[model samples]
Target: MSEPGLPPFESIIAGLTARPLARCVVVAPHSVEAIAAVAQVVAEGAVLDLTGDRARIKNLLAEAEVDVSAVRIHDSGDSDTAVDRAVDLIRTGDAEFVVKGSIPTADLLGGLLRQRLPGRSACASHIYVMQLEQFGGRTVLLTDAGVNIEPDLATKAAIVENALQLYSVLSSARPRLAVLSAIEKVSTRIPATLDAAELRLMAERGKLGAVDVDGPMPLDAALFPESAVNKNLAGEVAGQADILLAPDLNSGNLLAKALVGHHAPAMGVVLGAGVPVALPSRGDTVATRRHSFYLASHLTRSAATSPNGCDRE
Candidate 1:
């Protein structure tokens, strides 16, 4: 049976067949985990272009029972070069998105940044979209968990904008954003609280576009109405945030892992790029990887059709 807050795995795979399959470039695709992820996505009808050691990747794919004829392979000789080649495919429009394989996150991101791909945001951030069954089908967005380590105020704003853009694509309604902090009130000792306050002001001044932003809100208050009331917080976003902007990567990463560890349904994507980036952790299960690909595929199609398209140069 499907989890209450999440769609069934088979349903997500079936849904992909109705749309044009995204051409994905996988960097350093030789490890068992990476090969498994690729094969799973291939089964769902995505076109995969792999970059890595050709012989090794082929062997691994064969071992995984994936039909070699279906995938396009690019032999880049080494991990660094494989990542570079994958970025080039995205740059040349040969692929719709890039997925990390056996390569390190830093190396993959380095190749992409060096290419200076058009439509890339000033600061690319990571967003984890989580579905909590306990929340009665609520989808929550967490930002900068896997990318930005300690973003400054300007970078934080950019992160929020990137997340908001992606959320706008995934959701029909304007999303309510909660800038997370340790407490519900601003304190000079806590820099994040101050940053959150300023971010809220930015939203109010029409600087952050059409979104309801609240800040310095604790996690409980952000998600639970009773907690917000107990804290004497009264606002549309106080207990109804669709997005939770983490103070930094540490907090965001911890929060995301904790939820995932407890078996909550989640998927992550890197925003602020020419194409959507599916970045499932190495430790993530095959189910999570497949879901990430499904989300990235949908986002790719949505970005292409959006009025303010994501592929703008």
Candidate 2:
């Protein structure tokens, strides 16, 4: 049976299997784990283009029993060139998304940003879909944990907008966004609270689309009904937020790490770009990476079909 309040894992896998192959480009595909990730997705009908050292990639493919005929191999010789080639494919609409391999995140993102795909947002951000057992199988969306150091009000607005887009694709219900801050009250000393107030107003004014956004709420009040009552917080988003908009990268990163460290199942993707970027950490398990692939594929398909392009459900 499917978990309450969350889609079943088997259903997600089945959805992925039903879709047509998503064209993917892997940059710096040199490590054994990277090769295995690519192979796993390829078996699911994703057409892959592995760019990196020619001899090394070919040798790894041979060892993994990945058929050379099934994938396109691009010999870029180095990480920099490999990233460039992958970005070029994205620019030309030949690839739906790019997967990070053995290359540094800076290198891969740098190349992608330089190309500046047409549909790219002003700022790119990361969002993690986390399923914590402690949360009673609820999936929480957390943002800007992997990117954006310390965003200002305007940047935070964009981050929320980007996350809302992804949330719309994943869930059928209207998203309730809790803009997280240290406290629930807007104070002059706390810039995050001020920003949260502005964001809430923006959503109320219909500037941020269809999400029910509330802000200046603490984490506990945002996720726990009892805490919300104890704090005397009264809002639709309190204790029922589908998304958590973090105050900054440090807070967001720490929250996500704490959940994962406690063995919560999580997957993440990069948004605000022309294509969804599957960005699993280097230390992530193969299962995590594969799930990220499925997430990206679903986002890609959903975005393509949306008339307003990820901005509407």
Q: Write the per-residue lDDT of candidate 2 for residues 124-182, one digit (tens) a residue.
A: 77898887666655677899788787888777878887787787776667788899989
Candidate 1's residue-wise lDDT over 179-237, tens digit each? 99989889999999999999999999999888889989998898877888999988778
lDDT computed for candidate 1: 0.78
Candidate 2 stretches greater than 4 Å from native: 1-14, 302-313
Every model's TM-score: 0.90, 0.89
**For candidate 1, what's the RMSD?**
4.8
TM-score of 1: 0.90
Error of 1 at 281 (Å): 0.8
Error of 1 at 48 (Å): 1.2
